[model samples]
Target: MHKEITIFNETILPGESKTIHMQIAKLHTMTDLQIPIIVERSKLDGPTVLFSAGLHGDEINGTEIVRQLIVQKINKPKRGTIICMPIINIFGFVNQTREFPDGRDLNRVFPGSKTGSLASRFAHYILQEIIPHVDYAIDFHAGGAQRFNAPQIRIVPNNQELKKLSDVFGAPFTLYSNHISGSFRTSCDHMGTKMLLFEGGKSLDMNQKVTDEAIEGSKRFLKHLKMLATKHQSMEAHATIYITKSDWIRANFSGMFHGLKAIGTFVKKGELLATISDPFGKIEHKVKAPHDGYLINVNDAPIVYQGDAIFHISKELE
Candidate 1:
């Protein structure tokens, strides 16, 4: 049997389930704001997996995925521990914004200082308290703003272990990315935790398809670690396309935007992808594909400004 685990000064025995309320700071109204951390541990010894979301408060799709995992009892592991933190940035989530009350992006602050900004202190708390016990983690995210991203997994290139895990999870697309300084993924990596960053849908919106993809992939990931419960049968997954290089397609004109191409579809060179026209119905401009590639991100906004990114296409694939 595995030994007992402690979080936030509360000890959880093997095979026990507990919800720890992490109270960092109070709201302006003098009310306590608690971040609920749900933990489930199996009596048998195994890996500890963390499924976290809502790092950006507006990215509700990720939060929905984690919530479904809990509702469906998928977080009840067969021989390991499962921890779910559905809303990391509860402050931003309440305000429907992407940043903290201080306007600092939580994603940009990692392994933070105890005596720093509110966001930084929270970051420090997470790394110090939760990350040490995590063996593998899947952090969910969605596109920032109005850009709709096709369901995808992102990992740093040249990591064979992560690449193998990505193959097991089987996201439709897996992109190679470098570690961003002060990002949670980077900090996790430094702490020797393997993590897969899942991105899909868009901020402040929820898509059923995106949620389904993330949940399926998560099940596959758990199964690979021999931690999935017997009741849930892991589904067969398609081979994920590995993207080595990509670039954003920017709008050439400022106007009311009309996109013609769907996300996750390939387009030929110079093919018409979208149209930008003046609101007055004069002087329309066509946005075409720079080359043949798969469109992974499509802007959903009705309006576009010149040089605004409208599409993100894979330029090189593996």
Candidate 2:
């Protein structure tokens, strides 16, 4: 049971482990910057799982999770291989932005063309060079700046195999999201691969709880896939909810916002979600939930404009 794995366009024979840097672009002074990737291939044949993060560039928590996983020589895969791409958008990462410098989102340019934009080229390379070699994948993400998300695993409902893998990841919540066009999940699905999207924490902010959960979840996923034989304590079983639709609660008046609820809090229709007050404290307005659901995301900052998103609700089951 032997297999060959490639890292940063370089191939490694079976039972080999290596690190390679994938060149992304050059700096203003022509300094070549590359994204580091690690590949670990075992002698025995098993499922190949790819762990990718930093797709949004500012989502540092996911990037750190991949870093820690690769640095530590913990329980190695007894059968399959693990391919890790810690930073997928190096350009945006340097600028602490969610999108590439070309003003394009790398995540939204999946299965892209080689002669397209910068984001499209990177997406195309990933789809052709890496995705085809993996059996399963985990794309990590966090809420952008000013937004906070409860740790959860989002999977396509119809993909039962991926849904089962999501359960084993053991996130506090499991969200059933449909496949969106041009998303990594959509591209991978087209190639007959299963990928799970794990969302948690806030951009550029390190949350220990989210990091711990992600690390534990990744290990659990390996065990469930029969890639790791080591056993550990299991995470608490949480209610897995399916959200058919979700929408944002926007502010109707421009003012300073005072959030009354936090991420992971359940809210009812017409519930007070926040309060908007003028700078002089003379005018105040109450923001309420439009429907009953869980508060998956909420604006963390106190300042907002009249159409700024204040909260995001995903309908929950009774």
Q: Considering every candidate listed, which one attains the maximal lDDT?
A: 1
Q: Which stretches of candidate 1 lie over 4 Å from their true place?
A: none
How would you encode candidate 1's per-residue C-alpha lDDT over 1-318 as one tens digit per residue?
Answer: 337778899988889999999988999999998999999999989999999999999999999999999999999999989999999999999999999998898989998999999999999999998998899999999999899999999999999999999999999999999999989999999999999999999999999999999999999999999999999988899999999999999998899999999999999999999999998976899999999999999999999999999999999999
Residues 188-232 of candidate 2 have per-residue lDDT tens digits of 989987888999998988788888888888877887877764544
TM-score of each: 0.99, 0.93
Off by over 4 Å in 2: 7-9, 229-237, 316-318
Query: Clash pairs of candidate 1?
Result: none
Clashes of each: 0, 0
The whole-model lDDT of each prediction reads 0.95, 0.82
